[model samples]
Target: MPRLRANDIEQDKIARFERIKKAITALEKQQKQILKQGDLAPEGAWVARYQVSQNRKKYWYYKLQVPTPSLPCATSSKLSKYKHLGKAGTQEHIDAVMSVFRRSVWDEIQRIIHTLDDCLLDISSGSEQEEEEAQD
Candidate 1:
């Protein structure tokens, strides 16, 4: 069997990323369905609470809290805090939170693809230079 070329490897990666893109699209579409079925709440919880301000005014607001571990080297003895998400009880807020998470994942995928492209460019250029030198 012959050794695989760079193009062949890149083709495989491209196909894999395309499949990942499809999966992301599917997840995005299911966001609404999951929310309606109350399946999304398994990931975190939300609350509507009243608070008193310095002016003695009371107001009720919704917040989404997620339990996560504190920093590894934190001096505080507390183990975790309920991370404050955007305002709850609204579709826009939920979408915003989801977008934030999805954007992070998409950004990471783009970064990896960029790194791969850079590496392939370097390899192709080096091979081309070697071929040119041999011809001279």
Candidate 2:
């Protein structure tokens, strides 16, 4: 009977390491994007969609929507509707919020990636051990 080959296990470990590295790089890239969001407003704003009748023609209009827990934002209005941005300002509101959203996303991803560091190190050490054993 043939003994099990370490090469197969080494390859598998190498593949896993490569995957982890890719994930780390991707997370770094995402964090960079968040950093590039420029200055962010302290107030959190959102746009809500509603139907309006314009000369008997129906059209959708957007306004700064109410803040939700998901966004966790601050607004200029303590407890009032947002009209400071004005009508047709949905795009502006969303753009303003991207910084906050990106920051949260980046933070969450980094937190998750931090937990994988130990696993990465273990994989690396195991791979080296397997390679050395195979060479013997």
Best by lDDT: 2
Q: Residue 23's C-alpha lDDT in candidate 1? A: 59
Best model number under TM-score:
2
lDDT of 1 by residue, 89-113 (tens): 5674665456445544545555665
Q: What are the per-model C-alpha RMSD values against the true structure?
A: 13.4, 8.9
Clashing pairs in 2: 43-74, 44-74, 46-65
Supply every candidate's count of residue pairs whose N, Cα or C atoms clash at under 3 angstroms.
0, 3
Which TM-score value belongs to model 1?
A: 0.35
Off by over 4 Å in 1: 1-86, 127-136
lDDT of each: 0.50, 0.63
Per-residue lDDT value at 35 in model 2:
75
Clashing residue pairs in candidate 1 (N, C-alpha, C atoms within 3 angstroms): none
User: Could you give me the TM-score of model 2 versus the true structure?
Assistant: 0.46
Model 2 alpha-carbon drift over 4 Å, by segment: 1-4, 39-98, 127-136
> What is candidate 2's lDDT per residue for 68-116, written digit by digit as tens?
4333335542455443333454666566556446655766887878866
